[model samples]
Target: MSETTQRILPPTEALICFNLYAASHGFIRLYAPYLERIGLTYPQFLVLLTLRGPEGEGQPQGVGELGALLGMESNTLSPLLKRMQGAGLLTRTRSEEDERRVVIALTEAGRARAEAAAEVPGCIAKDTGLSEEDYHTTLEVLRKLRGQIAGLDGKPATE
Candidate 1:
């Protein structure tokens, strides 16, 4: 076979796709130790964190609203919410206006969990090489990219 016939390496797109997986793995690795101390798995922590507002000040959000924001299915998320409820970390209640819908709220213990999460930045500082500013900028860019991909025009892609 000619030299040109040799197998090519993965294409750039493939590399980018694999990079996302590897980066998520790296993030889990970096975040696990810190979050575990607060009794949260990565998914659970993400659920908790997403419920918060600026500086972790916010009321419990509705589960449908949370699911919509996370782009997750109720089938997948409902069980996790149940687990959180069992663990005394959060609550799922019926919405007053619409009894058919469920609302999710952090309990006192959930609030404690959020408070405990304040240690994450410091742990990340020790674990990851990215400077804080670089980290925040990367977060912004990634969120923007995600929003673009999700077609953020006042409605979710599902609609």
Candidate 2:
């Protein structure tokens, strides 16, 4: 093929997506034991974390709101919420003012579980061996990249 027509693809090791995918798996593996101890899957743990406020208080929220915050669709989040409710980790109640809305709140058990898992982040951070500064910087960069990528979903590929 002519030089202009030749398509050269970078090796997998040199691809950003490949590195991100591998790092995500590694992070999940690091979280596995801690999550298991808290009787949670990673997604379940994320739910608890999102439901918690900065001050460590559980914030009661509508199911739709919770799903949005977690970047989950209702169809996917519903079954997980149901399972959590069954496990006594949370309560799902019809909103008093809006029957169509289901509100989610952490039960005492769920709060306790969240507290128990509080150290998991620290553990995972330490395991990564990244300095505190580097860790925060990396997290910031990843979040920015994720947002930018997500924004491109409906846009033309060339853009």
Candidate 3:
């Protein structure tokens, strides 16, 4: 793909969406080897990254919070969280005040893994064959478009 705009774009919305979906996954695949060394699949890495965010109070985060922040449905999040927990990457517990709520926290092991994996962000950008500045600029524009498409009724996609 050249940096120039395509004279003939995709004819339909489905074509455009499918291309982006495939491209995004391909982009992640470029980082697959690096992420694997840290013991994270893309989704698992995303879950840890979400909970590592600075919540207002700096307290441990809950699964629902991660689910919303990550733009994941509860049903979808359950198995992912369970798998990560089983792998010792996270811990899920019910809040004493609210039994219905399941809080998720990084295990010491998880924290180290997250930190180790953090290096991949820059490395992956470098591997993309795009300069850091151009990469970030493109990411911002795409993020805005994704937000509009996803709609405010649901949470925005994970950063």
Candidate 4:
């Protein structure tokens, strides 16, 4: 067979992107039941988690702020925020200081839900079946990789 026509096994193991993508899907599946019990999808849960501040406070943020934090666009986030608002999980209000800016805040119910969902990280860590050392090591590597990629676009890592 010509080199161009030769068929070889796919190098799935060699592709970091593929591994990361697949792992994310796996984690989503694992998290589905937990999220469903609380009437949330993965992304919705992420939004609630992000809105929560230190000591369970709800930090009011703007749509732009949330989009920037989640790496999402307004077109996508607006509908999601609306859905959450409809569900009484959060509220979006026009800023008093800036009429053009909209601020988002979690409701009391949202705070309780977020607190309830805090156990998810522990569940995920347990599901990974990795030792504490390996888990931290892998997390650090991924964080560094994300930082490097962000830096390529002239944006520093958030931390």
Candidate 5:
């Protein structure tokens, strides 16, 4: 082989992307049992959490708006929303102001489910073994990294 052809790539363990991928999988595994008990998939759990909001009060949101918040395309979010609605977790209705807009609101059942899942983050945090400060720092770093990566190729990071 030529000298150029003999160049070696970084080992998988040394690659930040690989580490991040593995860490993500680890986190998912940690969340699996809790999510299963709640009868929600990871994506669905994310939707539920987002709709629950930080203040524990969720206002109705437009389909497009919800999709944007979740970083999901409407095509992907629509079927998930439909399934959630079928399970009586939420309601989808056309906006009176704009018939073209479909609004989503958590039903009573959804609120109850959200309440039941309240301890999930705490459980995951305990499993992570990160101190409060370290946890916040890690979150800040990850968010910054994600924003920078997303901003590549002239794409908006905040999206």
Candidate 6:
């Protein structure tokens, strides 16, 4: 279909939320092949990439902490964590000071996998067909949009 023709979306199809939702799925599809080679799903890769702290530092994060950072629910995240643990990607244990808190630390294998997947961003960027400037601008716009939406709760976005 021509670009101009595709622009004539139905009212329901014209929603920004729907576009964002579709884009998210497109992103997952784009990343899936690369992630598969590394034995990670898109969400699994996200968890590992987040946990792969500065310079491959395996910082221990509590389950709640990870949940908050990822904007995920503990109930949904727990099973994923268990799978990663079983796969030897990370270790999950109760905090010594607070047994109620479950802390997660990336295993060396997981760190290695994260490092290996570092080229993923470059690959995605290259495939996006957007100029570097346009890509960055889009990211900035999206970040601002997210902040503004989040701040609709009457809290300052900077907070």
| Clash count for each candidate, listed in order shown | 0, 0, 0, 0, 0, 0
Candidate 2 lDDT over residue span 12-121, tens digit each: 75678899999999899999999998889999999988887667878899999998888899999999999999999999999999999999999999998888777689
Candidate 6 backbone overlaps, count: 0
lDDT per model, in order?
A: 0.80, 0.88, 0.79, 0.87, 0.88, 0.86
After aligning candidate 2 to the native by TM-score, how far in Å is the CA of 116 from where it should be? Answer: 1.1
> Candidate 1, which segments miss by more than 4 Å at Cα?
1-14, 152-159
Best by TM-score: 2
Task: Provide the global lDDT of candidate 1 against the true structure.
Answer: 0.80
Scored against the true structure, residue 119 in model 5 reaches a CA lDDT of 67
Tally clashing residue pairs in candidate 1.
0
Better of 3 and 4 by lDDT: 4
What clash pairs does model 6 have?
Answer: none
Query: What TM-score goes with each of the models?
Result: 0.80, 0.89, 0.80, 0.85, 0.87, 0.85
Worst 10 residues of 3 by lDDT: 1-10
- Please provide, for model 1 over 1-159, each residue's C-alpha lDDT reduced to its tens digit, 9 standing for 90 to 100: 444534455454346557777888988898887887887888787787777655788577888888897788889899999999999988999989999899898888887887777668677876787887988898898888777877766576687
Cα lDDT of model 3 by residue, 88-124, tens digit: 9889899999999998988888887777766778788
Candidates in descending TM-score order: 2, 5, 4, 6, 3, 1
What TM-score, to 2 decimals, does candidate 6 have?
0.85
What is candidate 2's local distance difference test score? 0.88
Per-residue alpha-carbon lDDT of model 5 for 116-135, expressed as tens digits? 67769999999889999999
Better of 4 and 5 by TM-score: 5
Provide the lowest-lDDT 10-residue window in model 4: 1-10
lDDT (10s digit) by residue, model 6, range 45-89: 878888986567768899998997887999999999999999999
Ranking by lDDT: 2, 5, 4, 6, 1, 3
How many clashes would you count in candidate 2? Answer: 0
